[model samples]
Target: MIRRLLPLLLPAFLIAAAPASMADVQLKDARAEAQAKALMETLRCLVCQGQSIADSDADMARDMRSLVRQRIAAGETPEQVRGWLVERYGDYVSYDPPFSGATAALWFTPLLLLVGGIAVARLSFRRRRG
Candidate 1:
C-alpha cells in the first residue's frame, strides 16, 4: 500500500516544488489600468464558475491578469487584447460573447422560449374558454 501511494505522492510533490511563474502586475499609467480593469470585467475565469477573471483568485486568473497587463503595456487596444484571449481560450472565456452567427441561438433562446410559452398559454386559455 505504501509503495502504491508513493507513486501518486511523488507527482504531487514534484508539482508542489515547481516554480509558479507569476508576475507582480502594476499598471504604470491610468489609461492602462482603466483598460485592464474594463477588459478584466468582461473576461470569465475558466477555473471559476460565474466569476470574472478580475474577481477570481485562481492561478489561471492571476496568469490571465498578468497577460492582460502585458498586452496593454505592449500598446494593444482593448478589443485586440480581448480578441487575443478569445483566440487562446475560445468564446467560453468571454462573459459577453460576440453576437455572431454561432452565438445567435444563445442570445435569442431565452426570448424565444418566453414568446413560445406565452403563445402556448394563450392558445390553451382560448381552447378552454371555447
Candidate 2:
C-alpha cells in the first residue's frame, strides 16, 4: 500500500517542487511587486471584461504577470514594458492607450458623452420649466 501511494504522491510532490525550483524567478520585494501589480492593472485581459490582466486569474494573465516581472528585473522601465506589451498584444490589451491619432477618440469620447448628457439634461429642464 505504501508503494502504491508513493507513485501517486511522488508526482504530486515533484509537481509542487517545480515551482520552488523556479522560486528565484519570483519577485519578493514589495516595491517590485507593487510596480508589477500596478502595471498589470493597466493591462486588459484578452479573455475578460473590464477586468485588468492583473486582476484576472486566467492563464494568460499569469503569463503576462510573469513576463512583466521578468522585463522589470531585466532593467526595462515601466513605459518600455508597456510598449513591449503593445507591440506583442496590440493596443487592445492596454486599458490606457496613449493619446494619438488612431486612439484619440477613445480618450475623448467618454468625457464628450458626459458633457453632452449634462447639456441635454439642462436643456430639457429649462424647457420643462418654461
lDDT of 1: 0.85
lDDT of 1 by residue, 90-126 (tens): 8879988888887888789989999999999999999
lDDT of 2 at 120: 100
- What TM value does model 2 have? 0.68
After the best TM-score superposition of candidate 1, give how far the Cα of residue 11 lies from its true spot, in angstroms. Answer: 20
Predictions in order: lDDT: 0.85, 0.79
**What TM-score does model 1 achieve against the real structure?**
0.69
Off by over 4 Å in 1: 1-24, 120-130
Give the per-residue Cα lDDT of candidate 1 at 72: 90
Candidate 2 per-residue lDDT, tens place, 1-130, comes to 9998998999999876554353235577777767877888899988885788777866667677778887777778778999999999888889878778888889999999999999999999999999
Model 2, stretches more than 4 Å misplaced? 1-25, 28-31
